[model samples]
Target: MSVTQQRFMRRGVTKFLFLKAIADAGNVPLRPELASANATDLSGAISDVAGWSLANSPIDTPDMGSPMTTNIPGEDKADSSSLTFYEDLAAETIETLLTKGVVGFVVIMRKGDVPASKSMDIFPVRVAGRAPAYSAGSDPAKFTVTFAISGEPTLDAAIPASS
Candidate 1:
């Protein structure tokens, strides 16, 4: 048994992530920023890495008439990311992006005792919204919009401003 162990927990409200919409000349959020952008609590940015698969090819062996298995190095796959937030009538950034279908960058900043961050420029992201659901159940009444990353996302290049 090891005597030393690193124990840590995010007890406060400091644990959070931000996704800053990057816009181009056409006002698209498809480009990532150089630094962490100021993000709001409503903005939920989620990024994931696709698992690598082994690339194999069939090879002919001299001794054996059957084809031999040659294992190639596994290739790295691109990431799939998504951002979700409530529609803000005062600030129509997300609403406009969803309507215009523009390209932009999503900068992600994860804060803990040791902060970890990454950024990705997504293109042709599809934005969709849901109707305000009001029910007897427990849930907030708000229009939610989700942005799906459709293109190759650049990693760790730019950072968003801390909000």
Candidate 2:
């Protein structure tokens, strides 16, 4: 009997790349090449993340001909997502790069830093807000930056070899 093994996203292995770029005439940012020079790996700075998913609202279609109500998937919207990063003001850090109104693509590699042969999710996002999370305890200084997904994310796209 053969047993299948399951893989999980382990801490310190998952990578988040934030590419600061503008969209072209097509209203979509150009997909960056794998391991692009312009991409900034924000994994080390990021402490936590939330809500980077697309959700669909069902359209209720009830008819008099049937007792049961029929529903269809209407549209898919990228839910609000946020990344909490340890605030660092030393030179080019998360605080300086991720400011309000900055637009870019957020590539998430759940399988880790190994770019080749892995799948990644690309999200076109705008930095919506930035709020500092001050604490009186011994926790490190952190801030949360909210992202507004401008368009539908490209899910499960294969990561290519770096050029």
Candidate 3:
């Protein structure tokens, strides 16, 4: 097997990753205009750091050691992902949050050499909280947007062809 094939972990590129917001609550459509180059555009999306985590906790039974511990399936948990970017205060961007019209977020991890199959698409995340900060002490203004995974997230081994 190739060295790349034997590897279990693949390093993601931050530049290739993007965070998108859909005004409507539904499946995300992979449109050509949603590319990262047009991130500032209304049809495009924001930015995100790669390699965010997805995890779940398991219910356990006490005093079940010697042989094996019993673990019941608990609720699926998601670590909130935070995206930091400079605030341009664009009308479309500000309106999406101020008007509360955004429905969900999509994190797109573009495919690379390590993962030759396809890209990774994480979506349908709800906006849990957002903090748009401004400073007058020589520092630039930025926004920190946090999101919570809502319902069942579409996490696939490979990017879906229909996306």
lDDT of 2 at 37: 68
Judging by TM-score, tell me the better candidate of 2 and 3.
2
**Model 3 bad stretches (over 4 Å):** 5-52, 62-68, 89-101, 110-116, 160-163
* TM-scores, each model vs. reference: 0.41, 0.84, 0.57
* lDDT tens per residue, model 1, 1-163: 7699756432341222333454454322232332335333323421222221222344433445446544444534333434334445567654554443444443332233132233222233444333343458774434433455545544333333344
Per-residue lDDT of 1-163 in model 2, one digit per residue for the tens? Answer: 9999877755776778888763443223234543456678888888889999999999999999999999999999887899998877676477778889998889887786454534677898999999999999999988899999987787776665444
- Give lDDT: candidate 3, residue 12: 40
RMSD of each: 8.0, 3.2, 6.0
**Candidate 2 regions with alpha-carbon error over 4 angstroms:** 1-3, 22-37, 115-118
The candidate that wins on lDDT is: 2
User: Candidate 1 or 3, higher TM-score?
Assistant: 3
Question: CA shift at 8, candidate 2, in angstroms?
Answer: 2.3
For candidate 3, list the clashing residue pairs, or say none.
none
